[model samples]
Target chain A: MFLAVTGFAILRLHSLFAVVMLSGVYSLIAAAMFVALDAVDVAFTEAAVGAGISTVLMVGALSLTKQREKIPVHTPLLPMVVVLVTGAALIYGTFDMPNFGDPDAPANRYLVDRYIQESPKEIGIPNIVTSVLASYRGFDTLGEVTVIFTAGVAVLMLIGGARRRRRPDSRAGPEATRE
Target chain B: MTFVLAHLNYWVVVVLMMIGLYIVVSRGNLIKKIVGLNIFQTSVFLLYISLAKVAGGTAPIADERFTVYANPLPHVLILTAIVVGVATTSLGLALVVRIREAYGTIEEDEIDLQDDEE
Candidate 1:
């Protein structure tokens, strides 16, 4: 309910600054909910990345862009209809899903049992989530790290080239005059 | 009544997802669109975490005192995903900045208008 309110608030707000702040608050509330759902690690990450890092990045972006969302001119009827239809389909699809916390649901069975039962001895790590993330699925984490590194390099290159080009002020003088 | 109670989280997730989608589709501002994308992404994360829950389970830390733990696999996956989400978000913002530099406007309509003249 809290998250839903935050989402709606974000939708209604025109100020990008308020939107960014609400998003951070939304993430904080989501992190709290994650704790309720038995995903402490995810909650931690979401608080840091979704709330902390993303908010900072968005503020930085807003510094370079407009602060207010322009009131859209169109009626947006088509998009509203499309969203309603898609939402209805999603709700219908949820009918077949296991109840919120059924222990015997297909996803909670099989290898999950194995991992939980054996991880203590096999990996000798008390935290099954950590063991699985750092050991069982180490390669995936490595790839994800590589991806973050690539993103960093890509941002630098994209922004770096622009800065370098700006330094050649004499050339920009001619272009500015021609325009 | 039981059905609604059983799937409460899912219903909320769907609503949130739709809200995000609506913002993304209806809004013309580029920054607003990115905020919508963030909302959309967060809702998906909520869905995954909700699915990983076990009614009586504790957190996925191993202990003899605890008999059941929520599925750790999804937690692991979501952790990685959250990191990736931030990375992509930063990248997208960088692109937006570059676009603003080139076009001198971040309004989608304005950009389209400028393109049409060219």
Candidate 2:
């Protein structure tokens, strides 16, 4: 219920600061939901990443730009129609999916049994999530880590690194010309 | 009635996904768009986690007393995804900051207008 309310608030609110704050609240709520669903690790990550780091980064970005959204000149009707159609289609599609927590579901039926059954003998880890992530899917985790590294480098190159060099000269030129 | 009841969680998730999609499509503010994107990504994470659940199962830890365990694969996959999400978000915000520096405004329409004039 709170998640829905947060999403709605984010949708209706125009103040960028308020939106940022609400989105953080939304993430925290999402983390709590993850906990209820028995995904403690996911909840931890969501709280740390979604609520913590992302909020801080967004605030940093906000500091560089205007806070209030300009009143939109275009009508929102077209977007609204598109969203409703897409949403309806998605809901219809979910009718074919397995029930919420069916053990016999295809997602649960496949290699999961092997992971659950043999992982203790093979990897000898108490936590299956940690064992699989670190051993069974180590390469994928490495790739993900590399992707994060690349993103950090890319962000540094894009804004943090280049902006300093350009700030002293080009900053005045653009705003002056715009005015 | 059982079907609807059983799938209520999915329905709520779908609604959240649509709200995210709506924000992405309608909002022109670059930062707001990124927030929308985050919401969309989070909904996807929810869908996967929900799919991984087992009725009356504990977290995927090996315990002699607890035989039923939630699927660990999805949890592992989503861990990676959450990391990727944060990385993408930071990069996106970085781009937005640079956009503001280059264009003098973060509004998409205004940025386009500025580009046309230039």
Report the TM-score of chain B alone for all candidates.
Answer: 0.97, 0.97
Model 2, B1-118: lDDT tens digits are 9899778888888889989999999989999999999999999999999999999999888888988889999999999999999999999988988788788889999889988998
Provide DockQ values for all models, in the order shown.
0.79, 0.84
Candidate 1 residue-wise lDDT, A18-75, digit = tens: 9999999999999999999999999999998889999999998887776887878999
DockQ-based CAPRI category assigned to the predicted complex of candidate 1:
medium
Give the alpha-carbon lDDT of every model. 0.90, 0.89
Tens digits of per-residue lDDT for model 2, A1-107: 78889999999999999999999999999999999989888999999999999999898778777899877788999999998998889999999999989998999
Q: How do the residues B1-118 of candidate 1 rate in per-residue lDDT, one tens digit apiece? A: 9899989999999999999999999998888888898889889999999999998899999878999899999999999999998999899899987787777778899999999999
Q: What is the C-alpha RMSD of each candidate to the true structure, in Å?
A: 3.7, 3.2
Off by over 4 Å in 2: A167-179
| lDDT of candidate 2 at residue B83, scale 0 to 100 | 93
